[model samples]
Target chain A: MNAPLLKIDQLSASAGGAPVLHGVSLEVNAGEVHAIMGPNGSGKSTLAHVLAGRPGYVITGGTVRFDGADLLALPAEERARAGLFLGFQYPVEIPGVSNAYLLKAALNACRRQRGEQDIDAFDFLNLVRDKMRTMHIDEALLTRGVNEGFSGGEKKRNEILQMLVMEPRLALLDETDSGLDIDALKIVGRGINSLRAAERAVVVITHYQRLLDYVVPDQVHVLARGRIVRSGDRALALELERRGYDWLLEAAPAMA
Target chain B: MKALERILADFGSPADAGPARLAAAEALSTHALPTRRDENWRYANLRALEAVRTFLPGPAPSISPALPPALPGYSRLVFIDGRLQPQHSLPDTALLGSLRRSAAGSADAGPVPFAFSGDGRFGLIARMFAPEPIALRVAGSLALELISITTAQACGSYLELDLELAAHAQLELVERHLGGAGPTGLSCVQVDLQLAEQAQSTHTRLLQGAPDALHYDTVAVTVGAGAQYLLRQVSAGAQTARSTIQVRLSGREARTQIRALATAHEAQVCDALFTVLHEAPGTRSDQLFRGIASDRAHVACSADVQVSAGAPGARVVQSLRGLIDGAGAEVDLRPRLTINTDEVQAAHGATTGRLDEDLLFYLLARGLSPVEARSLLKWAFLAEALNAIDAPALRRAAGQGAAARLADTPATELLQ
Candidate 1:
């Protein structure tokens, strides 16, 4: 009714001259969580990256509308300033930039874009500390380099911490739970769930439904070969877990 | 050859010439200035040397130039145009008592040992014409700050610093080179360090010459048994700057660590060469170099480590990285290791390229402007070396200096 928060229509994209997503369409409304379940090479990450305006992807034919504006027209940074966040599957390790510095800089950048003043240093520290507690991240890690030498679970937790702090309008998480253990996954889920509001949307891209156990999605979509072939509720996720992706792969072509 | 001849002619021996000074002048007269053909001098900007019309020492400025704020917990020594300004120095009498000055023909005028094998012409020139050399022998813990300021006179300046640490002594030295407004001419500096058994020394050098200045520095160090020498150097100024460092572990269990960063912008050229030799058994050495070049600038670093057959159980590690940010800029890093013994552990890596694209994208994806992202990455690259500075005050000063050179914005903003 209020024009879905994000509208992707017939989106076809290619990476390195090879087509990855072929005429896929999806819509995500505010206040709803969507789970995009797909097997390896299903172009789940590509779809998320394309929407977030990552370079090196050529949109063959498509359009992405965020909040009724042409999302595909903005650069990656502008897209970020526009309240779009993409949680990288494998977070990068920036050895010389401390975690606190990055978090503060990023938060300030976003605030400046929104015509707001920079967050006070004292307030920022308190906010970060509270979020770190929720994410189960050690306070010492804030002084260390950004994810530098962090274990797999720690990196995932850091991504979640960043997401909770940024509070984007739409969050596209690409396999953030891949390397996370059960405890860490619960923390990450809590971190993500804390950001849900009547005006925010989240798209969780994963192969398994374990993350959904903590942050349940209102809608589930099975993407195979770059196209969403099935749409259902939470039962769809359990069904996929019960029956591997082969059945979907078998039905994907016909559905297309 | 003409440049060498001109320098020799301009720098006639002082009237009180000692044997060491005379020997240095004689050495220069016999050998031509090093050219590109010399392997060690291949990357040097020799043209800067040839451009000099005269190599005469600069006269003291009529007005004292402004100096950077002094570091806490250190006594300061100020030098203007190669001449010590005693009035501006803050001397700690107990430790300053060991400080000695030797002019030509003075009793302390013995030939200073230099481990550098490259063209020793620069050191020779400094020896022949520099003002009274400052020599310090330390027997107790001390912190000293030496500031050398070159005024806006188109004349050469030279300084030689010799340091000797007694057994089990500890010393921290912060040396800074600042240039006055406009062209500061050529400045040559030679430093020799000798560490006794179990002695430790931490030396940090900052070179911030004027935009049109030419700088050449040579540092030679010998570590004795169980002694440790650490050198943290940052070069962010001068149109053509070159520093050659050589460290020799002569006694068993000696150790040395060198962390150097060179930031070159505009059309400037910055070059550094580090050679470490493990001549005794159980010696260890670690070297890290980071260079950044932008806006048609050139930066080069060459690290060479050698383990002799007699130096069994020696360990060596070298990491050299360079970043080029401009289309016309160039960065070169070379890490070389030569081991003659089977019981040596050596690891070396060298890389020169633009900033990591993924790292850049990660920053951009977080809403940082491109300029902010680039500056942050560049700061991070240099911080790897700057962070190794043990003193927090010195580290912040160095970081601010480096950040200033890499960006047009305030260093505090960029560093943050």
Candidate 2:
């Protein structure tokens, strides 16, 4: 009866004047998780970046709607303030800004936008410490620069820690599990799982099915050549893992 | 050329002129001011100097000027218009007795007891016109604050500081140069530092002049065997500022560290030339400089390190970086290393670039406004050099000063 929380209709995008995504469509409803698995250069990351309003990407056709508003019209920061979070595949290292300072500033910015007062210092510290424990992050990293000199696993964990703090309405994760190890993947999965609620939606983009073992998405879609060629339940991920992308590429042109 | 001639004509040798003062004036009579053709003076804004009408010392203010709050555990000395204000100074009698305010170019102190290698013309000017050169000798642990304030006078102001540390002594010195409300004026400063064997000295200098002022300074230092010298400098004011610094590792195993930051905006020009000579075996030096130019400003830093044949097993490291924030702004960084000996380790790099776009986008993606993001990144870039300061009070003061220059909101919070 209710419209999907996010709706993408015939969305086509290009990067550097080269077409990357062609006529892609998808819908995600609140209280549900969707997994997008694709081979290299299949445009999975492009779709997520386009939805987040990243610079350097042009929407060639169609539209994206988030919470009944035209998402493509907003800037990156405005989209962020409107409760959209993107977990970058490779997080940036900012050497001079402390992790705590950035987290507090971001949280305060969001709160101010919602007509709420700044979070009390004491409360902010407590919340960060609790999330750090859940994400298995060291307490000392809080005072260090944002992901400065962090190991690959540590960077992923920090991204999850930030997501846990912001608690956005919709989270688009771009290969967040690529460099994570078994233990780190579990911690990150648990962090994302905690954000699952009746009013929140999640879209996980990845190359493998291992992350699905922990988060367990409700639906899985196979994207080939910028188009979803197959859709199924969680069993679809297992089938792809067993058969490999060669079988899909053989059948992709027919489906297109 | 006319400015130099005018300065020489205006200087009718005074009654207090000593042999050194006479020699300096005589040298200036025949020596010509350096032009853009000179290698070391190429980036200097010499046009500003040619516009000066008078080279006479600014008259000392009759009333004591307001001073910044004193740092904890540090004795304070105030100088207004090149004249020492003893009433405003709170010096420990025993240690303060060594600070002598001699006559202008007093020869009894003996030609600084150190060799001079920086631009001799400016040193000559200070030697010829400075009211009195303050010489201080330290034989034990002490912390001292020297504040020099230039008033609203149209004439030039000059000061020469002579500091010597005895063997095995420790000293912490904080020097501040501030400009009183005024129009454009010239401030020429010369500092000479000599450290004995096994001695240690930490020097911090802050230059905050008026927006329309001209400032030129030359600092020469000699480090003795097993001695350590550390200098941290921050320049954030003046329409045109230039500094030339040279350090000679005269004794074996001497060590030196120099860190500097220059922030220029709005048609300002800041230039610095730093040189370190390893003359003895096993001497080491590390230098780092960071500069930011915004809104049509220009910033330049040239760092040179040289190892002599006598200095085998020497170590040298130099890192110079500059950031430009506006289309018309310009920053230049040059790192030079010349080694004539074997078995030496030297690394040098220089880079000038705009702010990293990825870093900016990272902040924006977190909901920060464009201005806030830019301010934070700029503060962070300058903080890299400020973080090396060991003194908390000095670091805090430098951070606040830098934040104010960046127009960063809530200076206290930014520093924290």
Please state the error at residue B9 of candidate 2 in Å: 2.1
DockQ of each: 0.82, 0.75
TM-score list, all predictions: 0.97, 0.96
Tens digit of per-residue lDDT, candidate 1, span B1-416: 57888888886756777777777777777766788788878888988888886788877666666877778889999888788887888878875677788765365755655622445567777777787688888998988999988773667888888888999999898989888776678998888889999999999999888888999988888899999999999998888999988898999999999999988888999998898989999999999999988889999988989899989999999999999888899988878899999888888888899888889889898998888788888888887799888777778777766765674332274443
In candidate 1, which residue pairs clash?
Answer: none
Cα lDDT, all candidates:
0.86, 0.85
Once fitted onto the true fold, the runs of candidate 1 whose alpha carbons sit more than 4 angstroms away are: A254-256, B105-107, B407-416
Model 2: what TM-score? 0.96
- Candidate 1 per-residue C-alpha lDDT over A36-103 given as tens digits, one digit per residue, 9 for 90 to 100: 99999999999999998888999999888999999999999999988999999989999888899899
Off by over 4 Å in 2: A253-256, B110-120, B407-412
